[model samples]
Target: MKAYILQKDSQSLDNLCLIERPDPVPGPGQLLVRMRAASINYRDQAIVTGGYFGGRVKRDTIPLSDGAGEVVAVGPGVSRFKVGDRVAGTFFLGWVDGPPVGRRTARGAPADGVLAELVVLDEIDAVALPPHLSFEEGACLPCAGLTAWHAVVEACRVRPGDTVLIQGTGGVSLFALQFARASGARVIGISSSDEKLERARRLGLETGINYRRTPEWGDEVQKLTGGRGVDHVIEVGGAGTLARSMQALAFGGRIALIGVLSGHQGDTNPHPLVMKGGSMHGVVVGNRAMFERMNRAIEINGIRPVIDRVFPFAEARAAYEYQQSGALFGKVVIAI
Candidate 1:
């Protein structure tokens, strides 16, 4: 089996090495997955540079939380999956249903991830891929897809006539655009690049705001909605954009805080949220149940994840580089 492991010394791509290892085997309630594809996320870059939640890697680790493949074997007591089933791993290892509890370990950083030819997953920690999706598309669902679903569908309960404001044209934002559009919501997106904004419009974005051109885009959003503001804001840009998000939020609107792409520190006031009677929910990637529900939605809506590029398995490091290059409009995948 071939796997890429990030060494503990440098905590950068310089330390990421591809090596041969014995094929992983399934244990009790586990499934042996033959990984066909994996996707890079912003967090993967954070983890590689020692910027993730738990800081630097404590040991050599397989990096990446999102992957999809076929189940080649199932261990004793495993009932959720069978051989030949296509599946994707959940971001949080133990979050199968309900509220998250206990120590949460996500792949590609603290835990061994699916950036290998073969990997082991708890049956409870995996969900069957939607039938219509290929492995490369399915590989995207575990992180970005589920986070968008959790925000737009579960947290905001987006419905027809609702207005959704997504921060960028990145993976999660694009998925949120699709989900909100599927739910009959009008989607508005903001990006620094006009070309990306144009692409998002083609993806059902009702309006596009180039934040660079319209630095006070929140005010622009309110104007677009005739001063009513938006029902939901997919707030991915941490402190740098939270104040503007609050400004764009409608009365009783909900903002799902999913990332801190723009520096984590700032003096954003929360008084506007109180004034607007709005709520902000901090969304982790999501539970397995959420992943399953999102998959069902993907299947019914015929939604396909947007992939910006697919690199060969040997160029996994290049995939990571591309993700950080800021040229991505969607996901960067590794065809394992």
Candidate 2:
């Protein structure tokens, strides 16, 4: 089997080496997944640069939380999945049906990632991929996709005729836009590029705000909602945008804090949260139960994920570089 290992001694892309390794067999309650594809997330970048967990890794780690594969073999007591089933690994393997314990349960870093030709996953941590999607598309779902589902469906519980404000056209934001739309909610997107906004408009984005032009998008969001504010704000910009996100929410609306793209240090006034009584949910992807339910919805609605590009397995480094560019419209995939 072949796998990419992030060398414990280095933190750059140069440390990510693709090498041959002995094929792994499943243990009790495990399934050996013959990985077909994987996708990159911003967190993966942090892992590659060695900045994710304070830039110090005590041991080598596999890197990537999203992957899809075929079940080639099953270990004893693994009846949940069978050989030949198409499945995707869950982001949080240990957090099966309940709330996550912490980042310790996540795949790809503290745990072995799926950026390899083979992976061993607990049967309970793998979900059957929707029949409507391809391996590459399924590979994009575990992290970015599931996080979006958690924000829209679980945290906010957005309903039809409700308004959702998604920040930027990244993987999570695009998925949130699609999921919200599928639930009959109106979506407003904010991005720095007009070109990206135009692209978002084609994907049923009800309103697009060029944040570079209008720095105070929160005010514009209120104006768009007729001073009532939006029902939900997918806050992916971290502390830098938290203030505006709070300002953009309706009195009883909510914000799902999911990312730190815009830096993690800033001071936000606590007044809006106290006055509006809006909810703030710190989403950490989701549990296996949520993943299963989200797949059912995807299957029923025929929701095809928006994949921006697919790179060959050998070019995984290039794929990661592209994701870091922040210019892509959606998810970047690596087909194994």
The top-ranked prediction according to TM-score is 1
Task: Please give the lDDT score for candidate 2.
Answer: 0.91
In candidate 2, stretches whose alpha carbon ends up further than 4 angstroms from where it belongs are none
Over 38-111, each residue of candidate 2 has an lDDT whose tens digit, in order, gives 99998898888777855645578778889999999999998898999999999986778777765546788778
Q: Which 10 residues in a row give candidate 1 its minimum summed lDDT?
A: 7-16
**Cα lDDT, model 1, residue 187:** 92
Residue 320 error, candidate 2, Å? 0.7
Candidate lDDT scores, in order, read 0.92, 0.91
